[model samples]
Target: MRKRGKYIIDKRMKFKRGYQRKMILKIKNDNNLTWKNLADEFDVSIQTVMNDWGREFATIPYSLGIRMIDKYLSKEKNLILSYWISEILPKKWGQFLAGELNKKKIKIPQESEGLAELIAVILGDGHLERKTLTMTGNFFEREHHKYIETLVNELFGLSAYNIKLKGSNALQTKFHSTELIDFLIKNGLVLGNKITNKARIPEWIFSKREFMLAALRGLFDTDGGIYNKQKGYKRALIEFQTHSPFIRDNTIKLLQRTGFTPSKSASNNSSIGCTLACNTRIQNQKEIHKFFNVVGSANPKNILRYKYFLKRGEIPLKDKIYKEICRIKIIRPFKRL
Candidate 1:
């Protein structure tokens, strides 16, 4: 569900009891104010101020402390607040503050090839939460995750941190920024449940051929895969799968627009999801080549498979494919179109 209302700092900030008492006394004397006056000034009850001054409470909320520093104390006396904000705040609070403060530093990307590609990547393997943007992959795709980190940094001017899931093979690349999420929503992306929200390609992306191709590249790289139809088949079949009928239908239209005859079929599972396949045949080899030549892949796994097929005229067995990929020395880095 979407979060409502403006953001607020609900967490408390710790201060030494002695320091709290000292600040209350100093502010009261300097301004000739009583406890009630101070309470009114800080927008708190009289008992709240008295308890803080009496050291009855070891901490004050972030909102109260910040008001005291900003409104009551002079610049020279604000060092304590600065230190607490920088070094003593809880890690989650610190991250929240940093994200809010750094909002201005985030770059609003123009509609371009890179932006289209990022949108597709998000639709494939990313999620937009209330306060964060996250892209996840298998642990073995560390190199691909690094590429995504760089892509996000280049496009948004924000750094993405990686988290490896405990007892699992998943790795998450995430950044905190509600502003980025808002921008993405404005560009046709959805927060929370994507399939429930019916997320699909933005209309603007279909306005240009370059944008469509870039979006295709990102979607296929993240969610698509390639394999031989039979054990000894000489041709390869590339497939893109998704649970969203909106995405599946749109992807079929996209493949058709790009000059490929893609076959769509429903999954046998009860999930009602579907897959789109581009099969390489004597008559359709040119179309398969066209897919790679224009809407190429960024994933090393797909790249290795395509390369192996090109060299040997067919894809190898699963065991051999894994060994060959591990042995390959160079994995091409992603480049913006």
Candidate 2:
């Protein structure tokens, strides 16, 4: 029988929880028993064990379900997949993950004891993932963190603190995005592909900025042309680090105060920009897509979006304009902190 939503399990999965929970507590109380021993018995990632360590929660089972459950139980796949995606298999992708590969492509793995969590973050949905496995395993603070430090610096030329911006993605703010992509490719961690026959759009890659963006510092006003076709397809992604996320909000507030009604609607390549200038995004995406879809067509919406972004950069001084709206906020050359 099919399960509801994305979480169906063998009904037998419920066969043991209370007893296992008691045993887990017992094991925690035993001073002589090591986490290594318990983790081995449970057969879960060390990080999972640590996350559940010293914490009382719901039902207990053979393994901490943290690493595999939410993933497999979701829309993506199922545990039956473990049959093929395991260390001991005829075709072992795990062997490649064992690290130190002397081969072509300068390959990166989907999972690694050293890089699993990392690969997850970079190519992942770019959202927060909770894993007791990483927290209690104690590996995150030690190894994972160090790897992040190097990854952030080498790829973005920015630290965890600087990479994030007030907006969720780079094009969402005022940051230079093409520069960031060049940095990531130079470091060889993520991959970008060139999509052709697509209205002169260039390479595209999954995003990582959302996960790393800080809550406070945000990009308020996007100086360049905005996209209406693909909301986030712009090559450069704006991101926010640890600065106050309020910056963008304040700017929005300021814009409202200055009588600029943050108008958003679908425009064509002319308005949204078809060149590399509007590659990534600052949202206003309906316009970006509409622009592309109408690149050569007579579609009115596409024409509007395209035309909106291709305007001259020159800003004419008006008698009614005030100081705050024209004020260039303090923006620094981003360096990995």
Candidate 3:
């Protein structure tokens, strides 16, 4: 059963209780209007104006308040809007709007290793909608999601909200900011469907080896997987697979440029929309070790799998892998950059 609660707006957009009453009375006197007149102006019921606003029984919606200020108090509109933003809106919403109103006040970080990694993460598992940036991952990698939350906060001064998908083992971290979206687009990320846009690594990332490596780490952590090749063979394989040929080709080039020999393959199956799986793999055990040592992994699942492979010379079943990870403490918290 669903529990009843206050309206979402009432909880999200808070203001002093009697504020509506005070504003309604002032507007009535200054405009020489009756309760009916105000209700007609706002297309609301007379009871809504008199009982709700006049008797201080309910708070006015922000949109209604803005309309009142604009139509009746044009001279003080700016002042009143400022008051609404600073005093009525939630603190986080107010701060976000304030930053948007004055872009200079927003601290958009310059190019750095952290930023590069973020770009790769977005490329690997993120989606850019109209005004939101969302990244989804397996629920088993909750620790990695926490790390991404911290990384986003440290880099962009924005808080990411997590939502667990119903009926699935997936978790999503999402935030909405047009400025942030524009910043990402300016930094080479496409705004719509990435596969359609043919998204590739930003050229500037190649300018620095550290930036490239950080990006590689982000990509591998999000999209790459590691496991033993065969039940009897003591060999591990690190592989990255994507539907975007551009991304797969670029990833192979990136691995090669980073001094690792990576093999590539592709397969197409019409059963699943005929999407081609563009795959790149580093099959050499020595290179896999070097990949972990240099590029590293942010996802605890991947790290645990690699550690288990190193220790036992083979990967175990899913449940056993989970049990193994739980037995030892291996997740490294993300550090601020």
Candidate 4:
């Protein structure tokens, strides 16, 4: 006997009340769906749908409950409709708009150093949506884009294609296989509306030094930026910023573990989540050398900054490229203190 409550059903019902409540909520949340359509899908009368939601006496077969859950999980228009397969379906559908679900989990290359780096890159600039996985960069960051594309292919065995955003100078590499999407979701990357959900570094990735270093390299190259606060001095600051506290805290810890001392701060106001930042100054020549050798940047912008710092000992304020970065920083809220 289950507990009697708002979503509770009478013992007479075949389906649990809690399960019914979840199904009802899912239906209500989807703006395009209607109870009538759902009733038709389950081969039940519309009155049964009303009864299930309103605490009236309602009973549904176990098979119907499973189909309801599956429908809630999938997009209806994308379903593979077959006349022979009637309203009743398997617990899990064989196909969707994106592709068939690959139930087998892809082993996150736990032994490879590059795998950690790829994960970090995704955490920094990747969007793991339900139908696609994408990594984006400025149009000029061709090398960085290529690096990300190579990693995606090597790791997932799926080739990512470059897409230029309409009316924008951003370049994107997208992987559209549902199999890959499922594999990534199983490995801890959240799919769909990730900004609010906040993806973080998996604990397993932190188990090895090589993996950690590579991950940091990917993150810094994408999300981390370098700038010279002083006009003519050799001083440069490296900062990593994200709205996810999980990523922020873990990043700080990773930096500390790598023998670099860093300080963290949070923004007072941000719409999605508080902006968390960790930063450090290039204290000496040795520190700069270590950063390049151990945790090198993949982004062309950061790479250029690093090279300029090495040759000139400081980023020139008059340099057109650095000026562009600073100009964008002025306008972008992400760089705001």
Candidate 2: misplaced stretches above 4 Å? 1-23, 62-337
Off by over 4 Å in 4: 1-110, 269-272, 275-286, 316-319, 322-337
C-alpha TM-score for every candidate: 0.65, 0.21, 0.65, 0.61
Q: How far is candidate 3 from the true structure (C-alpha RMSD, Å)?
A: 14.0
Full-model lDDT for every candidate: 0.68, 0.27, 0.72, 0.60
- lDDT agreement of model 3 with the native: 0.72
lDDT of 1 by residue, 130-200 (tens): 56677888766566677677777789888877877656777878777778888898998887556657778
**Best-performing candidate as measured by lDDT:** 3
Ranking by lDDT: 3, 1, 4, 2
Flag regions of model 1 displaced more than 4 Å. Answer: 1-104, 268-283, 316-337
The TM-score between candidate 2 and the true structure equals 0.21
Residue 232 C-alpha lDDT in model 3: 94
lDDT of candidate 1 at residue 196, scale 0 to 100: 56
Q: lDDT by residue for model 2 over 1-337, one digit each (tens)?
A: 2211111121112213243334444555543556566555555333234323323222233233333334323442354234322222222232344523211122232222223223323321121112101111111112223334454344434333222212232210111233443333333233211111111100121122221121001121112222223343332211211111222233233223332333322222443232332222233444333323321211122122233334422222222222322232222211111
Residues 1-337 of candidate 4: C-alpha lDDT, one tens digit per residue: 2211112221222334354445465665664657677656655434346443423233444444446646565554233222112343222233332233334334344447777887788888887644457777777665677777777767766666786755777777877666677666665577534456666777777788877888788778777877775677787777787766667777877887887777767764454556444333444446556767777766657766766787887764324684444332211111111
